[model samples]
Target: MDNLVIAATERSPAVDFDFAAGVLSLKGESYPEDASTVFGPIFAALEGFLGVAECRALRFDFELIYFNSSSAKALMNMFQLMDKAAARGVTIEVNWFFAREDETMKEFGEDFSEDLEHVTFNLATTQN
Candidate 1:
């Protein structure tokens, strides 16, 4: 499938999905007025990709600075899907990046990682 790239906006993150490389990344703040409008297509493409992914491994990087509750929910759902894909024998790795000074974001990443199984989740920090 073709790559998916969405430029970042004031209220949304940038999405870069390299399907051929099996790598995806989302960066910036996420508090879109309509989370569905921003995430629906991504969810669809992700589901379709995961459904028939033949790649040996997939990597997803989430470098979000701030996100509202709806974005959190969307991310949890995405994580669930990734976990399910891992259960299906696809190797999945998730790198959740937070600023070193942002304890809240660090905790959020920890909370999200708690329920994951099969998918390898890592929490990385940035100097910013």
Candidate 2:
């Protein structure tokens, strides 16, 4: 499958989804003008990829400097899907990278990690 790559904008993050390798990464800030529009295709592609994935190990890395509530909601939705895939026998790992100085981001990562039952979520600190 073709990889999905989206360049980051002033108000959005860069998305790199490699379907063949089962690796997906999102980096930079996200406060898009319209959060749903920005994340809609990403979710669609992820759903399509996961639908056909068979016991494959998937890794998702999220390195966000900041994001609004809307983006957070979209992220939660993505996490839910990932957990579902994991529950269905896919090996899933989520790495959430946050700046050392950003307590809010760290807390958000922790909160998000708590909701996953099957996916392995890790909170890693990045240098400032």
Q: Which one is best on lDDT? A: 2
What's the TM-score of each model vs. the native?
0.97, 0.98
* Candidate 2, poorest ten consecutive residues by summed lDDT: 46-55
Q: What is the lDDT of residue 6 in candidate 2?
A: 97
Query: What stretches of model 2 exceed 4 Å from their correct place?
Result: none
lDDT of 1 by residue, 4-117 (tens): 999999999999999989999999999999999999988988998898895569999999999999999999999999999898899999999999999999999999999999
Per-residue CA lDDT of candidate 2, range 3-119, in tens? 999999999999999988889999999998899999999999999998988789999999999999999999999999989999999999999999998999999999999999999
Clashing pairs in 2: none
Worst 10 residues of 1 by lDDT: 47-56
Clashes of each: 0, 0
Note the Cα lDDT for every prediction shown: 0.93, 0.94
Evaluate model 2: give its lDDT.
Answer: 0.94
> Model 1, which residues run further than 4 Å from truth?
none
**Which candidate has the top score in TM-score?**
2
